[model samples]
Target: MAMVITVAIAVATELAIVGAGPAGMAAAEVAAGHGVEVTLVDEQAVPGGQFLRQPPPQFGVSDWLGDPVYREGRRLLERVSADRRLEWIMRSSVAGIFSNGDDDGDEPFTLVLNPVGEGDSGEGGAPRQLSARRVLIASGCFDLPVAFPGWTLPGVMAAGGIQAFVKSQQLVPGKRFLFAGSHPLQLVVADQIVQAGGSVAGVLFAQSSSRALALLKHPSVLLGNADKLSQTAGILWRLRRAGVPVRFRQTVLSANGTDSLESVTTVPVGPDGAIDSDAAEEIECDRLGVCFAFSTSSELARQAGVDCRWDASRGGWIAKHDDNMASSVPGVFVAGETTGVAGSDIAALEGQVAAIGCAAELGKIDARQAVELARLPRRQLSRRARFARLLSELAWPGASLFDQLMSDSATLCKCEGLTVGMLRTQLGRHPDIRTASAAKLLSRAGMGLCQGRYCHFALTRLMARQLGVPEERVGGFTSRFPAKPVSIGRLIGDDS
Candidate 1:
């Protein structure tokens, strides 16, 4: 690294949105439209969120408006990019949000970012730091992957990640692939793989029609925008037309492979949601796709000291926000899946609503306008939340998922390489030490790798079940400085 000094300019960078996904980008555009200066930062080189992915050039689609949600998302990004007041900073991450000093005599957020190498980095080299008066967090959710035996195999990957790779880089892991998981994603990925010149061995669905029936009770999912339903049906039709085997009510109990994934042993569960031994079978395949679904992006909000609660129906821990998407912490706001998992449409609406609230806070927009813009999403949220809740209840991961976790195998901390037995031993005689901090004190599960992203939910679930406490009653993991992993060298920057 070399040393250099750049002039630091002070401007009206009123709001900083942390993700370029639909929600975050929408917040920036809407806020800027209301006369506020906004900065939208994302780790990706482009603005589309994971769901509204823009495939690589080799894929032959300049703009694939295959679905209605994607079409609208693309339009939104275009509008945001065209706006002069909205600054787009790609290839940067919001390491942490701090209110440490008076910049220009104004108390604003201090954001730390790191830039990576060429292709991976949004711009070019290392990350840079900036300041903003108001901060809006919309860092979208990441897929939750539960490790199975032999899951460490090279050919195994999360379905969402695989789809992202196919869309972003026009790359496929293998020719023959097996995608097994909850509905929508399972069929969607299976169809994409086939379209991408990959062979689908089989589609093992962990959900059944019984769950789908429950999913329909909520009217919002029923009144789903025409585009989403079309895409969902199209994927299902493609899988059926391709003659791909579809296995329902089955889940991967274990992955069997020496070097890579050679086979997957699946257990077919009965209507009662227990594995039926008689229906268990082994499926041979070179690639395996597994997903435990997705969790919220409440890490930043949690780190900012906002109040959070666990809503299993909404997917993991979510921030406690009002109708306006304002967090408990003043001058801070949250939107999209980070608040809860309600799919893309709802996330977009929430993002827009958050922007309106932000405008009101900055005196750029009136409360009446904010209220009017927020109504549709509130109604949609109320209408479909029940059904989402039902589906979540039905799709809840069973306690058996972790029952057999090898005591000596990697546990609490995936990045730091901590193990379960080590964590258990650290608790010593404190039998009631069940919080994330307690687990961290014992074995550093939430302290390494993702800084609690991967293990936080699992740990909370396990502790709640073990102690017979309600999930909502359980507290969340506490984070420290450098909310994300940071290098000492980067902190010192050119001064080094």
Candidate 2:
């Protein structure tokens, strides 16, 4: 005999905001202020997304990092918490999105929500449903994994992951660390490690400082984002003061260790963005922090049947959105990294724009009022987006990095244990395998717990290389429902 559990379902709201990141919080505040009943759902216990992630109250952690983003996030959380029209569903994830009705009429988007217990345990819980007239997806991004030898080692971690552990948990991953990746976030992480009394062996950036310096040519752009530039400068200054070696145009070629990361082999990138094989060098470190960049967490949007297009600079396969952040699907809006890889500032602005658009569509506000309310946010979003593009271009991983770094023995899909050589063998057996999805079917490369989030980008690049086509042409895999895994018992609730 099988056991069954019953859980009560909550009432539906006029608007539902998935993800409580800056974008979701901003959207909820805006919509609630306009007299719309808004419910914000997020997987984390705290409301802030990764940028504004808050430590548990019991942790007694203060804002020692002095990040303006976190300060702003705290303010946003307080304001959103105080909104009477808004409800927060914490530690809950959207299992799936089901839509009914046609675009001609008001469509109802149903969210299957799975609420986790303390410490995110999946045990002893039943799924619930929440329906909304309009849904706004503000799902943020995760670190893009770059595959190489020994990446599966225990001490190897994403740069963002390291930052989160250090900032939120006051935990140090390792004593000595090698930070190798693209983006300024790595530098910030390194500084955090140093402040926490850990050692940073060195910092290696795949892009050259010359390209970043060239941004100074655009004085107006820099002036407009003076605080951001200042923040970057401060992080770099701390790293310099700590005597951390910072090298540009360099990337990790391989990580080596017996059971955990012990050392990393790095190579300088050439002018054409290919690794200089002759210039390879090895550095000793206990841990390696690497992140190529970020990929948009657009799985929810994709599962909702919204159209997406390939944009490499924006971290690939971003959902299509109009000026108001409304997707092709009627009554569905997308904001933040779900639409693209723009950072938290642009995400907040886009969230406001999305809320206004959704409010007008839902009859909470007139079209004229919505337009007037959205004008400033739209302008601010455009300005922030332009700056974000500049940063993305600077941090964009080199095209040849994958081909140069990935070895035949390296594990490409860590979840499924599918390696580069195994993928090659599958391609050889099935020459018809041209896209990532087809490769997944032939080799089970992406059939894993993560559902190909970590390996899809690399797989796309690999397939493109195998087929002699562009990466975009190779494309990505189809996202299925229950964006995150859910238990069968939870799916089928108790009859009583």
The top-ranked prediction according to lDDT is 2
> Which segments of model 2 are wrong by more than 4 Å?
1-8, 102-107, 117-122, 214-226, 494-496
Q: lDDT tens digits, residues 1-496, model 1?
A: 5533232332337888888787887778778878888888787777777866666434676546454535666788678767777787776666677775664445467676655344331333444667777788888887774644555567888888888877677688787888776535656677778887888988775657667434323323322232245556666678778888876777777677777788887888666666665666888888888755677877777877778887754657887888788888777888878887766666777788888888998888777877887787678766666555555555554545444332245354566665555654655556778676776666667876478887776667666766678766657777665566655544543324
lDDT scores in order: 0.68, 0.80
TM-score of 1: 0.87
Q: Compared with the true structure, what per-residue lDDT tens digits does model 2 show for residues 1-496?
A: 4643334675688899999988999999888888888999999887788877677757876554466635666788788867777788888888777786655544388888888662233455677788788999999888888888888888899998998888778899898999998766777789889989999999887877787455423322211223455666676788888899988888898889888887898999987888887889999999899967788887888889888887766777898989889998878899988887877777888899999998898888998999899999988877778776876776777657777788788899999998888888888888888888888888888788788888888788887888899887887788887788776655565322
Q: What lDDT does candidate 2 reach at residue 84?
A: 74
In model 1, where do residues sit more than 4 Å from their true spots? 1-12, 56-60, 63-65, 100-107, 118-127, 213-230, 276-279, 384-412, 419-432, 472-474, 494-496
lDDT of 2 at 44: 86
